[model samples]
Target: MNDTPITLSRADSSPPRSRSATWLSLGIGALVTLVALYLIVRSVNFELTLLAIRSANLWLVLAALGVQLAAMLFVIRRWQILLRPYPTRYNELTQIYFSAHLLNTILPAKMGTLARILLAAEMENLNVGFVFGSIAIEKVLDSLVMLLLLAVIAPFVPMPEWLRETVTASVLLVLLLLLLLVSVARFRSALLNAVTRFETRLFGAQSTRLALLVRGVIESLMNLTRRRELASVLFWTVCAILAGGLVNQLLFAALDISVPWSATWFVMVVLQIGTRVPALPANLGVFHYVVILALSVYSVNENTALAYAILLHLVVFVLPALIGALCALPISARLFALLTNRTQPTTE
Candidate 1:
């Protein structure tokens, strides 16, 4: 049997807000990007950066590109496995995944995930909560794997004071995430009840549909904790993490920079944590800065590190985004139609 479908429009998902607030968000995002770009331009020598890019090993660079694509495939497979017990077309999901990824690389504050979730729910007629629940589970698994890898490799890497602080910060972040998951899992009913009362009071008659969506989301979260499916989710997530590390190592080789394969975990950790900081579109300056900092810990030259960061980010961000845009065009049209036709006012 197919999974039950849940329909949602923007009106159902987002609380009504003012246009001025939307403009404020865009203005802030634009300001952040401009500042980040200014900092990057000041720091790197354009001539030297261009020279470094030209010097990269083309064969290894191509191989690195291949590795990045494979890594994405692994992640999508993991998502596929997570969405199991709910049948979905593999090809359709792949398109949505890539399209969502493209938007994510371009947009700030991770709107890509929600865009994909809403698009997928609209197209597949799947429950929004189920799709979102799978993504949430993916995040939890990613955090745990990061912590485990760090612990296993910490002894080998020298414990400089700065490194120690970074490790500590990462640990705290993981723990905080874990605590949040536990709280939600344990107290879902209370949380849902509180939110439901607020929505009903605020939205009046419109609250009935919104309350149902809230219930669907909470139920999906609860259902995902079931042991059989959870195991598959965990296993595939590990593959995705390992695949990420491989992408880092391949990019290192592509740049002809020597670092221990294990050290790539440090690169992976730093890169992930760094990008989490709010930045302009495509993670421009933030990605390069964190990569250079991570490699500098191992005594890599700043120019070479900058080159590596630039090439890797280009391959990682650009290629998929271009391809995903092509895939998303038709899908996005359908989503647009759904948004226009299905949205209704809260009072109605």
Candidate 2:
């Protein structure tokens, strides 16, 4: 049984807003990029900075990249496993990694989840439900994993109560949201009934659209239960996040900076926490300011935090373009456009 939900018209959907949004997102991202570069320059002596990468431990660089790549690979596998109830191509997983990262590099977001789903759905002729659900799972698990690590450091890190409270609020908010999803998934029919009734109350017969949405949600939940291949996906996600924590620790170490593990974890969590919020693409001005602020609690000098943020951002950001460009080599590269336009096939 194919569990993916069929999307009828994706091509006509040119980002809901306008061309202006595209331009705005680009401008925001570019501005952020410049600010980050400026910080790197300010952080160290000009001549010394240039020589640092040359003189910096190449092993640390490779280690960081390797850990990140491993995380991406596991993410791909997780997505594929989620699509298990339906037909899928595991080899195609790389395309998702590439395209998602491509959008991140050029657009906002740590990854282009929407683009990733469109690409996979079109290529496999499957629906988007499983993919969408899997992405949700990724977000939840990533947050949980990050929070779990922070929990360990909480007792050790000497930060303001407000910071601790904020993290707690963030974690709890996310947990509540996921709990809601799990609840709806478990009691889908009741939720659907409520949705239908609510629509009837609002739009009467026009509630057809809302009714359909409820149906879709129910179908998504059903698809998820078809198989559980990636129980280990969550397992590996925890490992990957831990590995990332270590990478940050090493980064500080190589720079001759000493931050308690808890402090560094807090910094890592905060840097990513900001990106998750919807903002201009590539997470422009927000990413930098947040990173700098997050690190300040650790008594980390602004210069070092700024420099770390710049390089760290690029490691996850620019690095993908290389891989995305490579993945684009396949014939399947056009998959997303095709999926988007599936409702109205373009005439040659």
Candidate 3:
């Protein structure tokens, strides 16, 4: 394993967005959350919602929670598969995964991915760009899996025109990304040489490091084309999706609700897409709104749907967050110190 300390560009150390922009985003997200909550309150009978919650089967709820954790494990395994070239231990990846999850819940705009890239690179003494590339590959694969799930359910469910359009756009985007990765991997040597020559002409002495970083990133992307790794990653991705579906199924069972498997899958897909939006910590109101909307299609009562959404959120979001917080505690101080030092301006 390389023991060299990772060097980050100034761009990496600092916030990508300005403070004012971040504040504006937070304000908008808060407004959206409030609006969603207001709509939910207006539509649901709180007393009935509470009664539904109160009467839920505890064992099924516990089972759903357990399945949610299993889903997280599948995600970790998929990431581990991507980092197969690196000297990574499963236990170390578990800590980093959960810690990133903790940050994702609190941070807006999926900043948890950035945190994961930094934490994984720093802890494992790996190249920062390589870690970033692995995450990129992971996301592309996830998008493909989600699209596949949507395709499977399309025949059974009458998707709204808007959803069909969104899926069409997503399919095009994922295809473009996949093509780019394949092209990069196929011509990695030529691309690296070109990058090195360009950087050398522009930056002179500092060119080598930049070239090496690019090489690391290219190598990471190359993993996608490897048949064995691709197959393994796909398997894990499917497993994670299945595990998530089971969690949804268990939650429905807990509420004493009977919905077709396709309905459950639809809800799962909607939740996946919905929670990706910029929102309050842990997705708060946005999550519940999406769940209720998805459940509404099946003629589920507003109160019952609300009850289901709240419980599902607790299991799928809150529980992971709590576990992630615990996992992050040991590394929190070190991570903070590293970021602080990196953010400080270097003196000549």
Candidate 4:
């Protein structure tokens, strides 16, 4: 008798356990922040760290920011390629991409990612599942590039246990996801049928809608395997990763942290992969922890190392977030409406 669409709203999609999990994640993030801050305060001479920051070349810092901002363009292009079926404008995607970065920095639980997916879906008249799927593909590509860098750097550098475990876990996760995609492609019909039957037994009357949503998600996963799309996506992804490494190297130079070029990969790898764990907004304590740990491997002192990490976080997270917020203001009304509106559902 009821015919309302199933929206991905907190009340509809998220069960009690999911809400509990979110609270638990927040608690973990808070604890991590406290521990990081405690360690930093105990180990580093705050005055000396401040002096190191003050002594940093202002022009070089600005140049580092510039390089990081430039790298975001390649990232946006890669995102656009993944979103081929929906076909968004270059300028619009740029705005959305950076806006998501702003959200990711300020919000917890990767909500920035969710923000972009929803924003793109709303703006482009596309299914949310499709957009989400594209984002997942982007993440997979990022993991592959990160793993490649680790492979290249592992032989020469004495990797820390944390770094080794992170890489191993990442590699296994990527492999599993790739295998899952292939399996779905090979047995699409059978998988869809199984999903439909499960939904039918679970939701009864709402099974039709749920089945359609599931099918869309599965199809989007399969789309990543298409040769042309995969090739283009991977190429841009690699470019983005290299550009990121360049940004880190420039930042290292700006802060006067002299290390080998490959050391940048170490910094990039840990920051990129380590922050994947639950942490405070903008990766807070987690970012500094990983950066200091990575730099320590190259014999950098705690005071100067913390300075580099703090400045790098500012360039990577804070400045871009500020710029992104400014650029996204014009479109904020629609984005806010989409996020807040509860009764209406965009169809699959």
* TM-score ranking from best candidate downward: 4, 3, 1, 2
Give lDDT tens digits, candidate 4, residues 7-120.
343223222236676688888988888888888888899899999999998888898888888888888887787766545788988889898898888877777776787777
Per-residue lDDT of 1-348 in model 2, one digit per residue for the tens? 334444422442223435576577556666666775566556545454444444556677667777777767766766666665565777777876686777766655333666776666567654455455566666776777777767777677765665666777788878896676567656877876887788789978653454553454455445444445445565666667766676676666656667765766787777656565455555655676677777778787665666666566666667766787678667443644443344453221
Model 3 misplaced regions, further than 4 Å = 1-17, 197-204, 207-210, 338-348
Looking at candidate 2, what is the lDDT of residue 236?
64
Candidate 3 residues 133-192, lDDT tens each? 888888888787788888888888878676677677788989999898979956887888
Report the Cα lDDT for residue 23, model 1.
65
- Candidate 2: stretches off by over 4 Å: 1-54, 108-111, 161-165, 193-230, 278-281, 331-348
Q: Count the backbone clashes (under 3 Å) in each candidate.
A: 0, 7, 0, 0
Candidate that would win on lDDT: 3
Error of 4 at 123 (Å): 0.9
Expressed as tens digits, the lDDT of each residue in 172-227 for candidate 1 is 87788667656667887787788778888987855566566665566555545678
**Best of the candidates, TM-score:** 4
Alpha-carbon lDDT of model 1: 0.72
lDDT of 4 at 252: 83
Q: In angstroms, how far off is 276's CA in candidate 2?
A: 2.8
Give the number of colliding residue pairs in candidate 3: 0
Estimate the overall C-alpha local distance difference test score of candidate 3. Answer: 0.80
TM-score of each predicted structure versus truth: 0.85, 0.77, 0.89, 0.90
lDDT of each model, Cα atoms only?
Answer: 0.72, 0.62, 0.80, 0.77
